[model samples]
Target: MARSQKQKSVTPTPPSQLDRFDEANSARLGLICVQERIPEDYTRWDIEFLVDDRPSRLTCISPGEYGGVPHGLDGDFATILNVMYLEQGAPESGIVHTTAYQMLQRAGFPDSGQYYQSLQESLDRLKAATYTASESWRDHKRQRWTTVKFNIIERITAETQDGLGFGSGTTLKIQLARPVVESIREKYLKPLDMSFVLSLKRSLTRSLYRVLDAHRYQPSMTAEAAAEFRINLQQWARECKLRETVPARIKRNLESAHKELVERGYLTSVEYEGSRADTVIIYTFGDLPATTPAPEPVIEVVPDAPVTDALRRYGVAPTVARNLVSEFGESLVTQRLEKFEAMLKSGYQARKKSALLVDIIRDQGGKYADPEGYQVEPQRSEANLQAATVAKRMEAEEAQLNHRLQEEFRLLDHSEQAARALTQVRMFVGREVSERTLKTLLSAMTSEQVEPYEVYRAVTRAASELRLADFAHELRYAYGD
Candidate 1:
């Protein structure tokens, strides 16, 4: 049996056709192969399959020129098979054809026939499939994260031997939850502490940017985070008993810094709030000026100084002196004072004349009317009646002229007619037309003109209608030449 035993024919298993295809395709196309479980929030389109122990995932998509499907028909089929294998990584002992068909469908090729298409068509279809699926998955993830919520909790406690209020304590204990503390320490506290301090130095170096910027120097980067920083710093300071007085060295440094800030225009002044010997220096960036110039003094001329002085001193009403001065100038005030004492002694009506004079000044037209010549009672009555008559007559004339000119101009189209109508309007209003008035008249003239004489006639008619014959004559004399 040993002599007759021939060499057993050993058959080597063939390399996976799909694997070979994927390698060719990878070489043909420069696509990266990745393997990761599609996130739950992602759509099915974004899901990709990978071969075990391989960096390349068999994407149902084409790759770069040298990485994916090769240049020919066999190469294209190899690429399709690679995609299928990626779709289903498990090998089938005999179910290879059925598995291939299923993968082809998933990769957007309906059947085996469609899977073995021309290289360009297959690549185009695969690219479209991959892009569409990836986009859908990305959108799904975005929507999912939009609804995600992160929760945080912070527990702050204060322990005081003196039993001060909530915020006031000698010893403070703060316990933050793990997640919240991690987040705060990672995203806010550490970065803010380092960055904010750096930012402060840079800003100071830049001269605080502006006076207002320096005034608003409280950290606005992260308000809550900055508040936490300040609270912690204060607590540390209190524990170290750094309040009431900073270390002498620190104080000297701060003083020097403040002086430099003032010189650089970053700060305006330094103030001390504590006792004279041990003062707390406070720096102000911008403060309003301390003193403003007083307004210039008014120089008032007072006539009859002695009398005016006495009147002012004795509390005599200023209205009386003002009235006397207004009525008889400076001399009247002196004369009034001379007679004032006599009038007061004789009881000869000291205030009666002053009252009459004040009343006369208050009445319209009384200032021009001679008080001694015009009898106040009759003159006021006659003037009222005359004014009423003149106003009524003028109103009637204005109404008549406006009505006549409106009727006449409504029937005319000449520029001169329009000018005349405007002139009539002016006359009705009782204003004299001048060189400026004539220019305005010409502006009102329309561009259309059949004849210049027609314009003259229209102006003449309008002047006659408005009873502004004098204005018409002036216009003729000016323009006729």
Candidate 2:
């Protein structure tokens, strides 16, 4: 008798899920150069834009580095780095622990000496570069546009290096700048389709896709996606730091990218309107695979589940309730819901109560964090309890100090406020940062319309940048212990 044979089943490997970036960084002007083969001697790049009907500037400066500012391949390295950082859970320390080999692998680069050398050069460029954004950086958490200066990679510490200073075994601790770190922590991010992005053949196309994605899909829009985008040709050139401002030149440069994107189903078409400087470029979206990965299969919450019942009682849709419980877990959903209920009981009237409750859960904002029913540790030592109490007291004191400082600043006339902020900036951050801060303040104030909040925020932020401990000490001394 012949024996029966069975075939083994094999599951296909899924495409890599590696893409995300702070929307601000992706959209910032002149942060990443679109040009390939930038001269090593190039040191600065600047771009101007109209933000809220006001002129804004972004400047990139790199000094004392042979690589000058980041351009071309550096942008690819940056995307890979950001993806790795998010993949590691966006630790509060702002440090992403990774290896050069791992980064190359994620970027789909081969493990070879040539690629390793290229990675090292990119790291050097990133470390040396600094960006100054004048009223162009969007702080989504604060819901404002503000001035900021930061490096893409603040510092890098490698555990082991070969003769070339970076190797496959070299473990890296890459620290992001405070602004970038804060944006990630606050979830001011947008999805990137790394599979599609990396598949693009041209660096310019990849750069265009990243910048355009920011314009196409924003965090604030209620619509799930944006289908069209329009921009002036000259302004687009300047935004991308392209040397070509003439319409024909710009279009010629973009022609290949346009064709590539259209062929890849990322854009339906790229069309032009008018001519010369008045030319406008229009981009129509296509059915590219979603930038975000598909959600995991939903596990429906049982009718008897406490979280589901609680959500239902609040008039949440069944599908929404199940997703909330499945995505954030029942424990956190319950916690946030309880917090929302407490707010309602305290006379906090919400126009859309269900929506507000969902926001409270998803945002994890401070408004709903200090409510009753917070999770507490099961056991605590006497010393640990004392330490926790001290920490809470310190936090309260810091909050009070911040409120007092802002209040005092608000009380001053505009001129007085500017003078005070400049003094503090110079005292804490030295002459360079102070001069830049003053320049931004003067520029903004001299404009026909000025935003006091933006000016004050910039100065205060600069003061806390380089010498925060000293700044705090001075503030405490002036205001009293």
Candidate 3:
């Protein structure tokens, strides 16, 4: 009677130590196409996503080299996705140029080494990202379904000259992966609200926003499979990828995230009850704008609409569809709905479903293929002179484009250059240099018609005068040498 097996003792991490998505408003919902797993729960990391639901999973490809995924927060990659959309106006061909300062400003990241370093991680993650989807959407060329894989960014040109991060480089560009570019070209991508996504402050809270954004009207907060826990605490913890097992602390974080959502007007009400073994979390997606919401979305309690089901299957009630429509154009949302219908017709079903989905946009729908670090060499015939000739022509085109952009940067006026120079100064030391002083120096540079290098020197001088010595590293980039 006294024989008891040895129980494994588990150490819990604190909330402060938990990893979260700290990147500003970057959760892109394009990978929203996986199905809920069957009744049996696999890993917490593996949410029960239903095929009808169109749940997406983002597999990180070693984030430490780029400085790790936003240092434990979610949404950094999403932010990169959004920024790319803003820069390229949706995955266009070839390379698209955008300053790190511009990207950082848009993503709500301060112009600092730490955040820039984090952005680097995000860049690395995107360059190496592999997205998988459960439901298939129709591409312009072909109708696609599950088991497709692709990278987000093909390559990134960021020069950390003098270690000034991605901003100081004379050139900065992000190349969207071919498959992703095609998705954008074919109108399969979902549009996320830059302001709303950026407004979310926490990883978990933002997760809810994403899930809710995918759903419409009142989405189901019910368990994915009939046999799965409706909302088990332990399962929920795993879905959130929380290493912290301390019950009291977990409760605090949960409550805090929930409260933040309600206060921010994303959810009308959230209730968690029942025992840990058998629990349920009810979510009521509140109307952000009660006046003119899209026709009351029919709550099918099924994955009827890929974009809507992507969030609703996980109990997300998206309240931002209209805002997204007003911004990203209506065609994108319509495409998501079309994908949902196609999946339903194919009798497609995702055996696995995750409980959490961002409620930021039900209009955005996407697909993911289970592909690893996307790189496939094109087959070349022996002595392929044609390929070589084409490559040279493309290279020539790129050089011409780069030259044009550089010329534009070089000839910018005082106001524009001053603004850009000020951004650069702040990039090194969190904007420690006074704007007025930097402006005065930049005005002199413009007035004297100084070279770009001279402008750099003036900024350096102004920084030193202002007692901001940390910009010593940024000084090296003055000449673009």
Candidate 4:
């Protein structure tokens, strides 16, 4: 029979069969080879195949080819075809050709007319002739491998783009059950060492109480005993080489802890039944260790002579004088006595002078009588008596002139004070004043002025009347006007 046109176009192609067999066999073999080498865990694998002297397991597949392979033919079609084969597969034969073209287009490969179409057509033809072998055995063998591969790929993509990886670079996401986070913080995050020390300190008080209750020691702990305990604790801290001071925060904590334990009825007082010296020793230790020696008592002695003198001079009671003598030494007592004597002597002299002056004035007429005494004369006639009186009056006037001259020198001191006040006011206020104001202010001051209180008052009043009180007050009080 002659060759039919249909037979020519679709021949019984043996080469196509051989090509399909070879491709399927190769794919199956590749899977088996890689399965043994690849790790089951995602963490162990690399994204790309490892390079070696042997043929590489991975084959690159272009989006323009191998698009028609059945899903069952590979565990992951894109990975198997695109990453395994170089897009060189059998020729197109049926509807698989059109499907392959669509897959390539979906994969973002350009549809550049005939060249891409021809490649898809070849891949489709290969798929048609390829035996549809059962993938069940391979799937069973490489199920773990396939999972690892998928995970690895996912991790690699996340790591390169999102910074997820192993070691310090790895990011962890934690999800705590409700209330667990707070519980964990409360149980663990508190200062454990401080708590431990506090507990130990509390236990120490209990131990001490047991000793006291058993009558193992002496009387109730005294202030000295407490001080000793503090000192010992400080020494312990020092010996331990602690960074903090013993008298500081640590000691405070210990004291608080001890007090708390005592309040909680963990300690009891023990009575001392011994001699006076032994009793003193017993109370000194309390429940603390009796290691440090007691400090010696300090006694001060004072003499009685100076104290007695001070009492008489200052009008202090005898009992008070004795107490002061006992409390302070003789030197301080003597110094105070001398000061009191000096003050009393000065006061007495002032009073005596005043009394004498008062007596002299009283003898004259109970007032400050004129220095000259009045005189009367019985002369030959009234004219003669009058002349004698006039002569006496002239002598009195001359005596009065001498007294006035002596008093004038005393007034000079006050005049200087008034002058200083005027100068101060002028310098501070810096205002021009009339001569009348100056004279009026000076006239009010004492003739023998020591301090310028009157002068200051006069100037202050004049400033107020002048309507410059604010400025003048500032000058007087603040600027020394």
Top candidate on TM-score is 2
> What tens digits encode model 3's per-residue C-alpha lDDT throughout 1-481?
0111121122222212222111111122223211111112221122333333665343322234443322233244444554455333342343565566656655555557666665665566566544443243334335534344555667887655455555533245677665555444444433344445556565455554554444321222111111111345654444454444454455665676678667765566776687544555666554333333222111111112234334344443333433344454334443333444344355556443221112222423434321343322333212342456656765765565445435545665555555565455544443334445554545555666555444544545555477456353343334222
lDDT of 2: 0.65
Ranking by lDDT: 2, 3, 1, 4
1-481 in candidate 4: lDDT tens per residue? 0111221222111111211111112222222111111122211111122112222232222222334322211222222232111121111110011123233332223334442444333333233322211221112212211111111011111111123222211111212211112112121111111111113222233223222221221111111223122123333222222223434443443354346434433322212333322222121223233343222211111113434554644445444555565555444444434433444455534345423332332242434222233222234224343456546765765465435433432454565556545544543343444444444445544444334544444454565467455655543443243
- Candidate 3 stretches with Cα past 4 Å from truth are 1-48, 53-74, 134-144, 164-170, 189-191, 215-252, 289-481
Give the range where candidate 1 is weakest over 10 consecutive residues by summed lDDT. 144-153
Task: Provide C-alpha RMSD values for all models, in order.
Answer: 42.7, 22.1, 19.0, 53.2
TM-score of model 2 (CA atoms): 0.57
Alpha carbon deviation, residue 199, candidate 4 (Å): 69
**Clashes (N, CA, C under 3 Å) per candidate:** 18, 0, 57, 8
Model 2 regions lying over 4 Å from their true place? 1-23, 28-30, 218-223, 288-481
| Model 1 stretches with alpha carbons more than 4 Å out | 1-268, 272-307, 347-481
Question: Candidate 1 lDDT, tens digit per residue, 383-456?
Answer: 24345654676576556544644554465556536544443333332234454555545553654433433444
State how far residue 93 of model 2 sits from its true place (Å): 1.3
**TM-score per candidate, chains pooled:** 0.15, 0.57, 0.47, 0.12
Q: Per-residue lDDT of 1-481 in model 2, one digit per residue for the tens?
A: 0111121121111112323343345544446877766676678878877777878888888974647777777778887777666654565466776667667766656668787788888888888888898887777766878898988899998755336466665667899877876666566666556656656677777777777766765434222346678999998887777767689988988788788778777788999999888899999877533343322211111123467768877888755886787887655676677678877877777898888888888874576555454443433312344356546765765575566557655765675455444333433333233334445644555452455545456546655465565654443343322
